[model samples]
Target: MSGLAEILHDNGFKVQGSDASENANVQRLKKKGIEIFYGHGKAYVDHAFRVVVSSAIPDDNPELVAAKELGLRIMHRSEILAEILKQHHGIAIAGTHGKTTTTSLAFTVLDYAQKGAGVINGGVLYSLGTNIKASSKPGGFMVAEADESDGSFTNIHPKIAVVTNMDAEHMEHYKNLDNLRQAYENFVMNTPADTGVVVCGIDHHEVAALAGRVSDRKVVTYGLLPEAHISADNIMQKGAAMGFDVLIEGKRYAGFRINMPGRHNVLNALAAIAVGIECGVDLETIKKGLMSFKGVGRRFIRIGDAYGAMVIDDYAHHPVEIESTIKGTKGGFANNKVVAVIQPHRFTRLNDLMDEFAACAMDADEVIVTPVYSAGEKPIPNVNREELAKRMRANRIQNVHVVKDPEEFNSLVQTLVTNGDIILCMGAGNINTWGQFIVQQSKLKS
Candidate 1:
């Protein structure tokens, strides 16, 4: 939403908004001369032409209520973004996971081409240093990370679409995995059948199945598998760095290296390479963009170094995402024991994937489980943090411990940490605060 405010202000629209508290983005926007209230109130929207909100906002928000009473226009964030996207040759990066990274890589490569493109991602992209990078070129390429949580990504179809991978996620809105897959199909089908191309990750069974159904438009397949149209082979990982040889149609395209840690990110880069290829970017320029990408905020991003230990953070809440993150950390820091600090995000998700969550952290040498960060959801019976640790113990996961309170967490960080340890903070909520706080304490101790 802050990104929207900045984009609107950049385009000569007077914009102001309200948030519950101040954050880095809010401070940055304030410096940009946009009026942002620290808290929600009816007065925030008193003189507004329209009140825009995301799916996270509730109907009872004071600003929204005031807008409705005053007969002012109200719009969803997706609605506003869709309008902005129409002006450019939009290329949407859509999937259940890895959309932000893929979108960032695609935008970086296209922007490196010097052809002028724009991007709006879910997180702060390291390449752009912001969520939205608007281009003045109307009808030029625009790369955006499509939000599939509320099924709003179907509102706009891009000239080229990249499917990183589709899984059974956001099931609250989707109701079932089949519905989610169908929604993805609808999103791809909306793309221009004459010129639009669908770049898909065939490693995922669901996404591969979706590709098979996409008959009207061109589909480009990318993955580790040899059968993929664009595939990565001869992969190597060395402590948050990866080198891989790219192959297109059973032939070598080029060998590329990236700063991202996981083997999973290879799939993401493949998607970006496909987009860059569609935009006429040379392989060298594409390599430059991929290799120079630092990382998305809180997605395996390093915070600080304490003695010989390295503290990194990530926004990996789902079981599949968490497993990948833990395994990737261990793979990167081979000699170091990876300590997995996990805080489950939502109650609905925990209730749904209890078994998966219980076993996902098995790769880590030590696992610290924190209380569920219920993002406004009510707590479920017997599905708290302790249960997760219990289940892990039952699954024969050694060194599993439940640290529910802040004091316990602080002590755990201070005493349990050792040299040659990768302290991984993984979650989608205030666990970032823990990561940042741990780093701050380490800095103070030195």
Candidate 2:
């Protein structure tokens, strides 16, 4: 939303917004001179301005009610983003995962090639040093993480669309995998016929089927599989990083290095490679661009190491993401024990995918489940940490713990952790604070 706001602001549109509370994202926007309020209320609404909000906003929100009463124009965040898309030769990165990384990487390539693209990523790009960047070039294009959480990607008719992977997620909003697949299928179908569709070939049959349906849509595929148009070959993991030789259209594209540890990131780099290739960039520039990426905030970001333990934070909430992150950790940190501090994000997701969450989280040497983040949703009857802990334990996962508050969570880690421990904090909520608390406490003790 802030990225779109930046785009509008650059295009001479007055923009202001209200978050439920202030955070890093909001602070970044304020730093850019965008007016932001801490809470939503009728008082924030103005007769002279239009209103834009995410789907998470309730229909009864006071601002919405007031806007309706005033007969002012109101647009959802996706709609406004779509309006911005129409102005650029947009390249949208869409998927259940890896969209942020791929989109950021694509932005980096454009930057290195001097394309001067505007980027709308879901996470903070460490390279750009911000979550968004408004370019000074008119025809430079806009690169965005086209999200499927609310089926909003349907509104973005990009010339180039990339799907990193497809899986069952956002179950609260999507009735089932079929519904989710249909939304993605529609995303591919909705793109303009003149551009490319890069789909992940490592995905399930549903994703492969969706890729097939868009075969006529200038499709170029990628994955670790031999059939992929771009494939990662001769992969090696060496201490919190991965290096691999990339094959594009059956030709060697030299070796690429990703400091962010994960096969997911390898695939993410591949996705960016596909995008760059389709844009007529040479292999050397593409490799240099990919290598130059430092990574994004909270996407396996290393906060610090303390008392012989290394702490990493990631914005992984879905089962596939969690599992892949664990796999990445095992290969990257060869000598450390993986301790997972996971905060489930929303009630609807936890209630729907409890079993899958349990299976994925068991990969850690120790698992700590925090209470659901709520996100303003009332709790479902039996979907809480207590139940989640019970289910994970039933799988014979012995080192499991549950904490509802930050204090106890910190205490548990401070007490149980030792040297050479790899503490990975994962979630989409305030659980990110645990990394800061742990580092602060470690400093005091030192």
Which candidate comes out best when scored by lDDT? 1
lDDT, candidate 2, 234-278, per-residue tens: 899987788999987788765788787888888988888888877
Model 2, residue 11: C-alpha shift (Å):
2.1
- In order of appearance, the predictions have TM-scores of 0.97, 0.95
Which residue runs of candidate 1 sit more than 4 Å off their true CA positions?
A: none
Candidate 2's C-alpha runs over 4 A off are 194-198
In model 2, pairs of residues that clash are none
User: In model 1, which residue pairs have backbone atoms overlapping below 3 Å?
Assistant: none
* Candidate 2, poorest ten consecutive residues by summed lDDT: 195-204
User: 359, model 1: CA deviation in Å?
Assistant: 1.0
Task: Tell me the TM-score of model 2.
Answer: 0.95
Worst 10 residues of 1 by lDDT: 406-415
Please give the lDDT score for candidate 2. Answer: 0.82
lDDT of 2 at 401: 96
